[model samples]
Target: MIQETYPMTVGGEEVLSERELLAGVEDGLMMDSTDSVRYIILHCSATRCDRDYTVEQLLHDHRARGFRTIGYHFYVRRDGTVSQHRRLLEVGAHCRPFNRCSIGVCYEGGLDAEGHPADTLTPEQTDRLERLLLKLLRTFPKAQLRGHRDMPGSVPKACPCLDCRNVFRAIL
Candidate 1:
């Protein structure tokens, strides 16, 4: 059962609720046990913030990388629409080594126009992400929230490009 409501505004135009955005998610796979979940890792597409990319494009990109499907469990578009790429139960390819115990969530932008790492999350995306994270936390009560860069042995990269631990500290 869902434990909370996520009401969000995207692009200063449309409003969507958590239920609305996640309504179409299929029960594609089931985790062996929620106990195995240790972290909810956040990521960014690394695309320019001004562009709108779809989940299909990300899937194709992942496929090119030899992944059978998109590497993330969830993908948040620039417009704040959330799409399910892989099921929560499936091991993701977003972060190495931690795949078996982590859930990956990718947002659309992490780059500025000059191609430098930046926190380019749209207001809508930010709002929706907060809600989504909260919901995931409720579902997996033991999981800790983390940024992709926060993982041990990760390369020097600003993935998710935001201090997710500080940003969501209240909820955590």
Candidate 2:
């Protein structure tokens, strides 16, 4: 089931697409046996759109912050490359409190050149994100999608810098 439909290059090395990683989930081989997922939380790296944040940098940053690995289940690069850093069934460390019942999908940018919060999602990212969300909805039909800042008890900060509700209001 690991079709090489989407080709991607990570750090000058060719890597398989996120689709290959999700094949298990697609076939029911990978799923939360307890069905604890209640939310699909979206986040952003909060890096400037002008800068490139590679998956390696993300892993390093998270590990430096005491995280065992990147907290997000999927990391979408600015080029629309989706990298599955964690398993779908594994509880993410992306958002506090909601990690136990949520899947975290993160994009690479969320700030402008001035470091101000802004929706810097590239056209490719927007397209891929919507496609990914559609697939996720197929798997977790009951999960509610929300932006990182929109979650209850979230700190007052613009981590994602976009209104996920409005972005996918028509689709969801």
Candidate 3:
């Protein structure tokens, strides 16, 4: 799936952009600074119980929650297609202390029957994650990959269960 273009349910082919980000829906608060991203924190969105929604729907929901913009920098679909969320080069609204220096990536559908993040990475999703991260590293060479738990206080809540170190070991 590491191709020049990606097929989308968004209706047509979306050429992967070398551009760091898109113009956010909000002009002020939504726009964060583009400092080099030092970390890539992975999270398992807890809404696995009942989510037939898309990344666009999730962003809309965040807007209603009063977010000036989307939270994560990228949203990985169950289908393995990644959608641009907030500006990757821009500070994100994902982590608290590290939000300004980290890039957040949200992968859909991993929670288990107990509502915990399943300790497994879907084959397709992992492959895409690897390819995308590799591409990002070329631009942000110093970026380090970590799980949501690795953040100063992110402390596990079921995410990146795939031995994160092994996942990004090659990139680092």
TM-score of each: 0.79, 0.79, 0.71
Report the Cα RMSD per candidate.
Answer: 13.1, 10.9, 11.5
Best by lDDT: 2
Clashing residue pairs, candidate 1? none
> Which candidate, 2 or 3, would have the higher lDDT against the true structure?
2
Encode model 1's per-residue lDDT on 1-172: one tens digit a residue: 5435445543342224554333213212345778878999999999987776788788788766656568789999888999887776777777877787889999999999888899998889888899999998888877999999999978747898889988767777
CA lDDT, every model vs. true structure: 0.78, 0.79, 0.64
TM-score comparison, 2 vs 3, better candidate: 2
Task: Compare candidates 1 and 3 on TM-score and give the better one.
Answer: 1
* lDDT for each residue of candidate 2 in 76-117, tens digit (9 for 90 to 100): 999999999778877777777777778889999999999999
For model 2, what is the C-alpha lDDT against the true structure? Answer: 0.79
lDDT by residue (tens digit), candidate 3, 30-82: 22333356777887665563454487778787666545467788888777888
Error of 3 at 75 (Å): 0.5
TM-score of candidate 1 on Cα atoms, chains taken together:
0.79
